[model samples]
Target: MHPFALIVSEPIKIDIWSDIACPWCYIGKRNLEGGISSLGDDAPEVEITYHSFELAPDTPVDFEGSEVDFLAKHKGLPAERVHEMLDHVTGVAANAGLDYHFDTLQHTKTLKAHELLHFAKEQGRQLELAERLFRAYFTEGRHVGRIDELVELASEIGLDTGAAREALESGRFAPAVQADIAQAQAYGINGVPFFVIDGKYGVSGAQPREVFARALTQVADEKAA
Candidate 1:
């Protein structure tokens, strides 16, 4: 009789720190998903954890006009040049299966959004709401910084609106937001789309699928040992 083949199974966890306002972060997320799915059913059961990292932490609650205007004003670029950049990003986003509506995007700080995401974590819908928030800002052109908009988005994703609003209004999740930022700083992570595989391997930027695939396999091997 042939000897039975041995297969080692293990568990893995991925912690991701990103912000909704970040475009590359969403692209990186899609790449990571591709790598994970390639591992198949026999692969380790992975737990995904989302962390809050606001990209535009200093943005104001309201801006004078469009995203283009805001970018031009903040970066000192010509309005035409900023629009051109927005066009380029919009094209890239579409190719990545995302609909980017920068024209309607209102300039606002993300502190409240981060706090709301922390609130979503308590209900186990942190990942979903995070994705939704990204979509709303980068695609739907919704003002993500406002409490009412966040409450509406939360409710749309099956969370309790009242609870989310309360959390935002009362600043309940402020500590969680600060903690994530502090941890990122502690880890020397000053950017989005940072991936920590099995809590051991860290990858930054919008890495390619193959890179993530290799990291996934490496982490799996380390765990099976």
Candidate 2:
């Protein structure tokens, strides 16, 4: 055998733009994780960075209505139509092992939640906090828009809640959240759950695990070549 050791390439970077209030974003997250798992032992290492993208920036911090009501008002659709849409997505979420509770969902402004994500990034717990936030908003129907609730969530993920509160209250990470949004606009992305692989390939919507697997494999092959 040769004395030389094998060299491993740098991990592929995946930048994901998503909103906490987006059900599809949560689905996309699970699909992405599934894709990574499908690669098995030979799966190329990947670094994922979550970016902020608010779908309903104009929404009130405390929207006093059901999810269906909020959707009906915001999208100019009837309650029946909104219910249908929610039901379809809820079924889709179930297939992806997500329990979506739209009935109890609090449709509130996610700017504060996004800010908390940025704070988590600085603490090296961005991904953990992202999953927590998604579950909190969609599954548990927790109020992620409030500072106190977000601080509690941060602590759940083993982050420094004190620092998280300070960062959020001071709005220090608001600019970072805005920067991510600006970058998304520059890319002409108008939706959540948008994935940019290696900063070259763009995958929109919550695609199947096979689709993500193929994309990752293709990028790995290209980089290897």
Candidate 3:
């Protein structure tokens, strides 16, 4: 091999459409990370970008119900059925190393939270903010819809809280959020935790870690070819 011969591998770009309020999205995130880790030294360089997708756009900023109540009404399912579903998802989340607290979860609009994600993206802290928001809402039962609460989360992640507050309050990233939604619609996506790998493959739902690993490996192989 010539010493001047170099191997250049381009990173796979993954566009993820998820809502902060979606339990499956959080679980899927963990599974995706797990998949990447499973590859160990063989893991390909990858860039992930989270896009906005509102699961409940009409939910009030200060929704007056528990997660179960909200789901029951939103899906028009019986209260008992919602409880069963939450229980099942809670177990699934636990398997993904997540502690979902549906009882204490405050179901509210996630538009402001999505806006904050865009602000974080501008600061190159989008991934950090996304993880923080997921844990805050799912495990900590923190209110993610309020500007003040979001600003606090931003501060926790070493962001400029003042700027975060101003951007969120002024709706600076609303259009970006809307654009993401429009793109999702164009892709015929109607679910959360949807993964688009290298603009070629579409992997939907909170799939097992092995599934994600296969997708990543396939894309890497194509790039190599």
Candidate 4:
């Protein structure tokens, strides 16, 4: 195995292991961006690296229920409670400067989605594709579990659609995706939106902007020491 390199840049590095289908992961991204915005240009340089985590590894490619229904069944919550929870999440998303179209999200597995993410990384458009996938899955009612749909989405992100489709078809990056999952397990991660700063400190969940700001500041300070 190759030796692991520490953050080589002058700026602190934040590695985020998240799933596109996860609502809190999207919120966590906004929170980090918000903290960075508040930190301004002079804020210590920051390198953001995205890793993969699957919230529902065994979910079906063609999930057989509405998102609300799926969540209800999965969590064994009443439909009313599920709706109430979604309403809360929607409000939280709005506060974080995002749109939550929970009703539009398809409840499906995202293994292929992660593979495409790796492909996008090679093309230097992983973040863009990630954002577009989030929007498509969470707000556009798009099915991210299918290769064709993911390829079409890649096209929207200005990625090489043909290459992306071929990669997906050939099951490239499956190991990368699985390696990420294994790393997550090794780190004792049990959920999405897990943020690792400077490869040491970990922050989890969709915390508020202040929380993210503090974490960034702490990591920057520690590195300076």
What is the C-alpha local distance difference test score of each model? 0.83, 0.96, 0.96, 0.88
Which sections of candidate 3 miss by over 4 Å?
A: 1-7
Task: For residues 24-118, write the lDDT of model 4, one tens digit per residue.
Answer: 99999888888877877646788787898998887899998788888888889999999999999889999988887876678899999999999
Tell me how many residue pairs clash in candidate 1.
0
lDDT of 3 by residue, 55-169 (tens): 8899999998788789989999999999999999999999999999998899999999999999999999999999999999999999999999999999999999999999998
Off by over 4 Å in 2: 1-6
lDDT of 4 at 130: 81
Every candidate's CA RMSD:
3.7, 1.9, 1.6, 4.5
Give one digit per residue, the lDDT tens place, for model 1 in 181-200: 99999999999889888877
lDDT of predicted model 4: 0.88
Give the TM-score of each candidate.
Answer: 0.88, 0.97, 0.97, 0.92
Best by lDDT: 3
Q: Write the per-residue lDDT of candidate 2 for residues 97-184, one digit (tens) a residue.
A: 9999998898899999999999998889999999999999999989999999999999999998889999999999999999999999
Worst 10 residues of 2 by lDDT: 1-10
- Comparing 1 with 4 on TM-score, the higher-scoring candidate is 4
